[model samples]
Target: MKLYDVIVAGATGMVGRKMIQVLEERKFPVGKLFPMASSHSVGKRVVFNGKEWTVQELNEENIKNSHAKIALFSAGASVSRHFAPICAKYDITVIDNSSAWRMDPSIPLVVPEVNREKIFSGSKIIANPNCSTIQMVVVLKPLHDKYKIKRVVVSTYQSVTGAGQKGHDQLMKEWNEEEIQEMKFPHQISFNAIPHIDEFLDNGYTKEEMKMINETKKIMGDNSIQVSPTCVRIPTIGGHCESVNIEFEKPFELSDVREILSKAPGVVVQDKPLEKIYPMPIWAHDKDEAFVGRIRRDETVKNGLNLWIVSDNIRKGAATNAVQIAEEFIKGK
Candidate 1:
């Protein structure tokens, strides 16, 4: 077996740390792991594959010196915007978990289960879609293939972990009745829900919401499919859950819907209303598969179906997805 030298940018971040863990859990063929972060995080220790690795500073010189073949970036958009091109210039395939490159015409916004073929061996920069978008699209892809989706309405109850460790720390501090040292969110998150995820756009949709709307079209490979999303940050740590209502061009039976989703890749059907079982974040945390439940019909609209989707925001939504893209690249190679 051949191992590849892998660099994980933003190694100290929530998603970055999860990336390392996922790599180990999935037994990715990593020969040398270069965990790179900012200067302040330099020399920090991170455990990967049962071994502690010192974090390296992310700079032009460090990146150029590492000679890594693949770079998984969970750094901020600005960091990714600056460093991803450099990695590409070095012939390193970059799978980025940031909004900086998702909308770029050249960069492939990939959900391996949805459109793995979009990523070819020569593809340099691959963008991981927003956390909410990833779980939803994994469920949407198969249904759209059979029913031909027309539009989708999604309302997300996202976990604070999606915001990063600061968001998680803030929630813990507030729950402990401690002084609020820093605010990662606009308001208090304990027992509260904020209908805002990212910066509000001029059109009233947030950057997070728009990412879902547009990225859905791109990943599903359909411009005609419309998406209306309302992303909210709630006080939870398990995962992010979404209430997705989809309108299809053709009619479908509930049994067929259930069977199709059960057979879909990267999706798990947990819909059993009478038995009082459904998909929830508590069960989704740490899991890679997207869980779908609460399957029913939206009688008001023509050929409308409703679904509840849940998945760990950090795992499947960011780290696992990025790693899957890298897996696809290696398979093609």
Candidate 2:
């Protein structure tokens, strides 16, 4: 077995730290771990594979000298935009968690279960889809294959972690009734839900909502598939939950839908309405699989189905998904 040197950008941040943890949890063939971050976060220590690794500055000198084959980037879009090409220049495969390269026609917005084949050896930079989009597509792919999906309507009750550390801190501050200093959210997040995730666009839909709409089509490889999304940030530290209503082109039975999702990779069917069972963020936390429940026909629309999708945003949505893409690369080898 050959071990590979890996670089984790933004090592001190929430997603970056989780990337390190997932790499170890999955027991990736990692020989040397290079944890990189901004100047402020440098010298911070991250434990990987039970070893303490110091965070280094993400400068050209360090990136060029790291001798790493794969770089998992959870840094902001600005950082990814500036450094991802540099990693690609050094022949390092960059699986970016930011939206910097997701819409790029040349780059592949990847969800391994749906389109692992899009990735190839020469593919230098692969864009990991938005956390919300990743979980929804994982469940949608199997259903879309069985019955052609025409449109999708999704309302997300996302976790505070999706906004990074600041978001979590904001919720905690509100929960503790401390003095509110800086605002990560527009309003209080504790015991309240904000209908906004990212910046509001000219189209009245936020950047996060648009990401769901566009990303879903791209990952599913169907531009014709329509997606209407309203993303909300709720006070939760566990995971993200979505109320997904899917309309298929063909009629389908609930039994077949349940069977398809149960067998789908990275999907867990938790529907048991009679037993008072369904997916929830508390139960889905720290797990990689997308939990799907409340599987039933939407009586309002023809050929419609509704589902509740839940998954750990930090795990499957960010860290685990990026690691899975790296795993796909290793499998190709």
Candidate 3:
């Protein structure tokens, strides 16, 4: 068996670091691990495959020479836009975690459980779906396949980690009696939930909301499906939670819905409300699978189902999803 040479771009950041961690956790065969980052992050120590490694500076020459078969990119859009194509020139499969190229008509935005078939052996650039979109689609895909989904109304209670390390640090500063002046979000997020995630657009929806609506349609391969999302930021440091209401074309029974989700791949149904056994962010931290509960029939309309979904924003949302794309690609090869 030949080991694959893998490079994790932006290797010092939260998601990039987690990608390296997940690759080791999944025991992915790696011939060499090239941890790529900016010059400022260069020489930082990174542990992988049970050995200490140093981060390398990301540049045209560095990327071309790495000879990496796969590159996991979690750097922001500006970095990804510049470096991902350089990696592609070397014939590396770049699975990008940023919002960059997600809506590109030529690029396939993928959720492994829902649309792994979009990945082809020749694909050089693959876009991982948004953190919120990933978990919803994991649950929605199963229901959609069964009853034909018509619309989705989602309000995300996202963790501070979704804003990356800066957001997490800001929350901690406020929590530990420090004055937070300038940070990622517009306001402090210690105990209060801000009803905003990204910049607000003219349409009164945040860019985060638009990403959910548009990405959901693209990843699900259905433009006819309607999505309305409100993304919020909370002080939690681990997982993101969502309250989702779905409407289907066909009627569904609550029991049948639970049965369907229970058997779905990459989905864990935790709907025992009476036993105090429902999914929560604290329990979902560091967990890979999407945890779903609060399943019930929407009373106002026929063929409507309500659900609560939770998962680690950094793990399954970003790093794990990117690595899963690479894993499926390797499996097909």
Candidate 4:
């Protein structure tokens, strides 16, 4: 098997850690793995594939000197904005898990199962959509192909884990009978839901909410498809759930929708409402497949459908998607 050199920036982050795990789990043809972090994590050891790999501090010089041909970046957007170009300059193809370049016309904002054919080996940078956007778009792509999605109104029950390790810590701290720590979220996360995920914009939509709207359009390749989103930070640990109402340009049968979703790559349809079978974060946790359920026609509107979608935010949303992009790059070679 051929091997490729790779680097994972933000290796200490929740999504970054999972990126490494996915690389190992999928056994991507990695010859060398450079684990990168901020200065604070320099020299720290991270165990991968049962071996201790020392973490290296991310600096422009190190990034330029590294022989990594592919780099998966999950550091915040600022870090990505500052360093991603530097890596790109050295001919490294970056699969970024941040919103930094998703909107860039030059960058291919990709979800492997949806727009993967757009990916090319010559593509220097690829943007992974938001976790909420990733699963919803995966479930929507097949339906859109069959019925032509006209618009989407989605309400996300996003997990605290979407916020990162700090979000997870906040929930655990609250769950452990401790006083509220105002770190991960603005309000109490345990036994409560916060309507806000990211900073609020003038339009009253949080950054997280807007990402869903914009990223969905980009991923689905349908700028005419309008998306209104309500992103909430829920207390769940692993998965994110979405209540999506879609209006199709063409009519769709409920049974046909379920069959299409069941056959869609990276999707698992679990709609058996009679037996209380539906997608839940608890059941979807740690899984790579997006779970869709509650397939029903919206009685209020013509050519309208409603569905419930769930997926492990950290896996399919972040790590696995990035890994899939890497796999796409490998296959191209």
Say which prediction, candidate 2 or candidate 4, comes out ahead on TM-score.
Answer: 2
* Per-residue lDDT over 1-333 for candidate 3, one digit per residue giving the tens place of the 0 to 100 score: 768999999899999999999999998888899998989998999999889888999898888888889999998999989988888888998999999989998888988899988987355999988999999999999889889999999999999999998898898888788877677888878879899988899999999999999999999999999999999998897699999999999988888999999999999999889999998999999989999999998999888889999999899999999999989999883
Give the distance in Å from residue 257's predicted Cα in candidate 3 to where it truly belongs. Answer: 0.6
Those runs of model 3 whose alpha carbons end farther than 4 Å from true positions after fitting are none
The residue pairs that clash in candidate 2, if any, are none
* Residue-level lDDT tens digits of model 4 in 1-333: 889889999999999999999999998988888999999999988777888888999988888777889999999899999989989898889999998999998899999899987687256889888899999999999988888988899999999889898899889988897775467687778899888888999999999888988888888888999999998888998699999999999987777887788889999989889999999998999899999998899999999999999999999999999999999888883
TM-score of 3: 0.98
Expressed as tens digits, the lDDT of each residue in 235-320 for candidate 1 is 99999999999999999999999999999999999988899899999999999999999999999999999999999999999999
For model 2 the local lDDT of residue 252 reads 97
Candidate 4 has a TM-score of 0.97
lDDT of 2 by residue, 1-333 (tens): 988899999999999999998999999999999999999998989998788999999988898999899999999999999999999999899999999999998999999999998878367999999999999999999999999999999999999999999999999988888987789999889889899999999999999999999999888999999999999999998899999999999999999999999999999999998998999999999999999999999999999999999999999999999999999998894
Please list the Cα RMSD from the true structure of every candidate, rounded to 1 decimal place. Answer: 1.0, 0.9, 1.0, 1.2
The ten-residue window of minimal lDDT in model 3 covers 115-124
Candidate 1 residue pairs in backbone clash = none
What's the candidate order when arranged by decreasing lDDT? 2, 1, 3, 4
Candidate 4, overall lDDT?
Answer: 0.90
The TM-score of predicted model 1 comes to 0.98
- Candidate 2 regions with alpha-carbon error over 4 angstroms: none
Distance from true position, residue 86, model 2, in Å? 0.6
